[model samples]
Target: MLKRRLLTAALLIILIVLEILYLNSTTLAVIFAIVVALSAWEWAGLSGYLARAQRIGYVAIVLFLLILVYSAHSFWPTAITVFLLSAAVLWWLIAAYWVLRYQQQCDLLPNSSPLRAWLGGVVLIPSWLAVYQLHQQYGEYWVLFLFVLIWGADTGAYAAGRLWGRHKLASHVSPGKTWEGFAGALLVGALFAGGAAYFWLDESEALYQIGFVLLSLATVVVSVLGDLLESLFKRKAGVKDSGQILPGHGGMLDRIDSLTSAAPFFLAGLLLMGSLS
Candidate 1:
């Protein structure tokens, strides 16, 4: 299992690197849109859409929304983007609360309900917007930074959890996660952020290092939230993995779950920093 996971992860990392470095903004946008659409298809399954047509319809809606956003981006006011991003962050907070307070109660939502289908939009859209906007404004380096932080935290958590995990982080939502794993993620996040800021980032100062740490910590938190929320959906839907697309990764949604939360939060922070600076 671990070997398959590692191999899949390595291949994904290589593909992501190539995409970030070589793909132009327009090309990347199209590629990411496809990804969002595919994730929506998987999310539909987790949302209890058993029929193939319904899942494909959900993907079509997601694609339409992506196109709408892309077409109207020029008209989308700065205030609106920030507000939407803020809303995305708040949604994660609510999800975290659901994980903590109403772990079982929240699962009572009907499996066939439309809410989960809409939720795919709520999760996928902002992430795509954030990725495209970051790539447009800050270049692939900044976009890569987002991916790296999430990947680093995820890798760290898995390693630490396997080796030294004891206390549960949120056993109701995800039994495998642990507080020790969370700590390891933070530690790894900090190290990766500090190094990336100092080495790869254009501006590397003490203040930047501090900012990166804070940003990274927040990213790690939200990334975990994303993972738990998906677990919640899967648990509610009575499924184990999201899909069987990737050999060991389950699905694209499973792979990018952390990014779904991290992207918006990270972009919001970056936009705020840009406005201030």
Candidate 2:
């Protein structure tokens, strides 16, 4: 399992780097839309849509939404973009609330529901848009920054949880995570952002350091919530993992859960900060 995980991780990294460095914004959007479609398919299964046709239809709906969003040419803070991004932000907060009240919802809600199906869109489309927007507005480096932030958080959580995990972070939703792991994620995220600011931004201003650190911390919180939100769904659905597409990674949704939640928050925060400055 460990060897497969490492091999898969290496290949995924290569593919992602190639996509970011070589692909144009439109091409990247198309590729990411495919990923989102796959995730929607998996999400359908979790939402209790076992019929293959139903799952395929869900994917179709997601793809259509992506096409609709992609056709638009709005920059950040544009009315439409802000509306969409704000909706994603609101849904994530509601999702966080769901996690906080997991036991109640898990017990009361049906395994498959229309709400979950709609949630699949809410989880996917805006995130895809956020990534594309970042690539369009800031270019490859910012796109890479988003990846590094989320991936670094995952790495830190795993290492810290393995070495010294004790107190449970979300005992019901996911047994493997711990408060120590959460702390490790924040610490590494801060370090990651700090390094980016130092080397990439090349700005020694105290304000830049503070902004980056705070943004990193906020993103860490949302990213963690994203993981927990998926775990909550899987737990309620009574599945071990989201799917079995990747050898060790479970599925695309499993791999991109953190990104699904982090992208909107990260981009929105950056936009707000950019306006402030």
Model 2 scores a TM of 0.95
Model 2 residue 23 CA deviation (Å) reads 1.0
Candidate 2 per-residue C-alpha lDDT over 41-101 given as tens digits, one digit per residue, 9 for 90 to 100: 9999889888999999989988988877766644333775698789999999888877877
Candidate of highest TM-score: 2
- What lDDT score belongs to each candidate, Candidate 1 first? 0.85, 0.87
User: Candidate 2: lDDT of 149?
Assistant: 88
Per-residue lDDT, model 1, residue 68, is 84
* Model 2 poorest 10 in a row by lDDT: 103-112
Write down the worst ten-residue block by lDDT for model 1.
102-111
